[model samples]
Target: MSDSSFRILIIGVLIACSLTHVRSDASDHRYKVGDVVPLYANKVGPFHNPSETYRYFDLPFCSPDGIIKEKREALGEVLNGDRLVSAPYKLNFRDEKDSAVACRKKLSEQDVAQFRSAVEKDFYFQMYYDDLPIWGFIGKVDKEGKTHPNEYKYFLYKHIQFDILYNKDRVIEISARMDPHSLVDLTEDKEVDVEFMYSVKWKETDTPFEKRMEKYSLSSSLPHHLEIHWFSIINSCVTVLLLTGFLATILMRVLKNDFVKYAQDEEAADDQEETGWKYIHGDVFRFPKYKSLFAAALGSGSQLFTLTVFIFMLALVGVFYPYNRGALFTALVVIYALTSGIAGYTAASFYCQLEGTNWVRNLLLTGCLFCGPLFLTFCFLNTVAIAYNATAALPFGTIVVIVLIWTLVTSPLLVLGGIAGKNSKAEFQAPCRTTKYPREIPPLPWYRSAIPQMAMAGFLPFSAIYIELYYIFASVWGHRIYTIYSILFIVFIILLIVTAFITVALTYFQLAAEDHEWWWRSFLCGGSTGAFIYAYCLYYYYARSDMSGFMQTSFFFGYMACICYGFFLMLGTVGFRASLLFVRHIYRSIKCE
Candidate 1:
């Protein structure tokens, strides 16, 4: 196909996909009485290790018939380890059942062993009925046994009581309650007769369907957590304000005086050897080495920045709710893929501006810069999940689909963007002329070195978000559901402001110390925040959370590494952009003849 035809095809595909939401009968949500309400049994996993999940039938659960039907799920749902399959229990809308035996099976020795293992590990099963999710533990452990003082007893929860709340035609809420009376002891060696029973009670509620998910967000402890988030946000705001104040002082008082003195000296024709940043004006704006890599980072960072803002905006508008499984992830994947063009354009244009000749190489690098590492990490983690037979492993079809999307949709857009960027490329507009020979950077004290300056630059920004990071980690790794996007949005802005101000300040100091190598240093200074974040991840994994086991640990670190790498790119871009502007503004203000 021609380039234009391919572009049109890609755009059409994107539009079609975007128009398609999660395929579900629950979209309308208005159901008549006696309408079949499909109940889907999702995954089962140890409650402590959320990442490690298995198909519900992976256990010796009673099967309905010959071949169980699996519901078609969105990309996000599949990625989230949700395997929605038809359950044995049958229920209709508003059709309440007093009691019904779902299935009856004589447990074999192997079955008993599996149940015992699951019960001992505190395994929980998830189910969905009419789009509302419900969770219940498979079994329980009793520490106080009748036989001995310190002996433990394991019992399976054989009966499930489903209390489903409805408002007129719409199902508002659902909860699965286990009955203690129906517990079966797993201590016996003989084959046990297990009758899996369930009771459905439909209750009428005055709550509107729109407000159904409010209950999840209004947990008793949520207010306290929100209060803490508010306090942390306020603290970050104060920090940004102080940093901004310091930057303003330097810009208005120190830099202004220097500019005025330099102007006077130039007017008087007094060329008495210049000092400080004024002497190195020729080399300050010189394009750094590895122009392609720098440009690629900037491009990838730009794309990430845009993606973050868009996702947060969607979240604030309630496009992604806590109850909606995989909506956020789905949105993220689609948005990131669609926005590949931005990365290509920015990276290619910047490279061209730096007088880079390798357009094809730059475009390829920009396309793979972030996705390469992410793909590798995902492959490793997915391998581990597959080895463990965990539901977190992507199905072969899903992996193929993701790869196809990247190759067809993302790659084409990136190439088109790079072509446009290269065709429209302009020269680097530096205010000061460059000298043939580079200026020798003076020896600086330990604190003024790159590492120390990066440490200082990264610490301030990391401090702004460390508290918020705990909440994020809790939501991502633990069982907590995060819904405070407004607060997250606030903290996000604060982090950017803090990063920009701190990086600009550090760049100014570097220039004052006569270091013409501020290009990579500025990027590193901003990117160093990722290092601090990774450190916090270690602290959180070891001390703040109870997450263990090889699968969960690998998944956690692999994904966190990807997230922190993104942070490095995004913040590093922010820092570099800010420093570039500062450098340009200062150079333009002075007479550099």
Candidate 2:
């Protein structure tokens, strides 16, 4: 195919994929009175640990038929541990069903034991009908909701009442409630005949289809800490504003005075020795060691930065919502793959700017910088999930699909971007030229060392987001649903501003100390925030959360490592970009001869 045709085909494919996602849910279809409505049973897991889920049929539940049929789901759904399968409940649009026995089974001793165990762990089952999710407990503890194995009575919820609300012909909301009276006591060890019963009720409502998900957010069983989230956001904003104020003062007053003094000294032809940042102007722009790695990091960071902003923007516009299973993950994967070109262009352009050859090597490094680690981690996690028979495990087909996307879509775009970047004529716009011979650096105090500077620089940015991080952790690891994208976006912007200002301030200090090797140090100083975030993850795992087991622990830390690594790159790039601009402005204002 011609280049333009290939590009057009790729664009068309992407648009088709996006449109498919938008209309993936069954609710998007307009149904007549007798249209068949399918109900899909998702995963079931302990209420306390959200990440550890298994297929709904893992337990000894009565199947609709001897052979089970699985429903095809989106990539996001699979990643989020959703194993959607056809349920036995049969209903048509606008059709109401009285109490009906959906399935019947004679429970054996093993079956009773399974139910007992599930009830003991407080397992919850998730189901979807008309693209609306419904959740209910598998069983209940009878002793005043306490899980005392010796005293509390365990009962299986054998009957379910699906209350579905509709606006005209469109389903607006769905809720599942267990019939308390129909609970079957699992205290006995003997075999029993259990009849799984269900009733469907369709009611008319004024709520529109677009607003169907609002009920889930408002009436969620999980705790809503809106006030706490707002407080944290406000606190972070104040911290950022103060830091910005300090930075503005330095730029406006201190830097202005330094510029005036330097210009005056140049006019006087003073032979006095120069001090502070002014003394290191010649070496500040020197290309650092490991040019390939540095350029790759910047490129990956640029892609990640763009991905984050776009994800948040989509969430703000309601393209993703709490009830939409796997939507966020799906978006993340697709966007990351599509934005691979940004990374290639940035890495290539920056490498070219530094007068580095071996462009192919640089491009390869940029492509693998983040993805290599992520792929390895994912492989390990997938292996663990497979071992444990967890629903989080991706099927072989899904893995093949993802690999194809990376190989075909991501690799090609990255190469194209690299080609474009290499052909560009723009050069590195450094205000000062580097000296032929390197200058000898003076010894600094222990407190002024790179390590200390990184710690100090990283802590401020970490502090600004730790409170918000708690909420995010809860949503990801616990049962809470995160819906306040606006607050999250605000916190995200605050984090970037704080990171940039703090890194710039520290870079200024490093330069004043006559440290010409600020390239890697500045990057490390900003990236150190990821280290702090990982530390906080440890603290949260131990102190705040009750998540346990090898699978959950491994998954949590493994994925968190990837997330923090991305943060390190993205924020480090921000710091480097800001510091580069700051250095150029300061050097450019003076008469450098």
- Top candidate on lDDT is 1
Best candidate (score: TM-score) = 1
Native-to-model Cα distance after best TM-score fit, residue 531 in candidate 2, in Å: 2.1
For each predicted model, how many residue pairs clash, with residues at least 3 apart or on different chains? 0, 0
Worst 10 residues of 1 by lDDT: 12-21
Relative to the true structure, candidate 2 has a C-alpha RMSD (angstroms) of 3.1
lDDT of 1 by residue, 372-484 (tens): 99999998999999999999999999999999989987898888778878887577879999988898888889998878988898899999999999888888887777888
lDDT by residue for model 2 over 44-81, one digit each (tens)? 98887787899988988888785678887877788788
Candidate 2: list runs displaced more than 4 Å.
1-29, 32-34, 143-152, 219-226
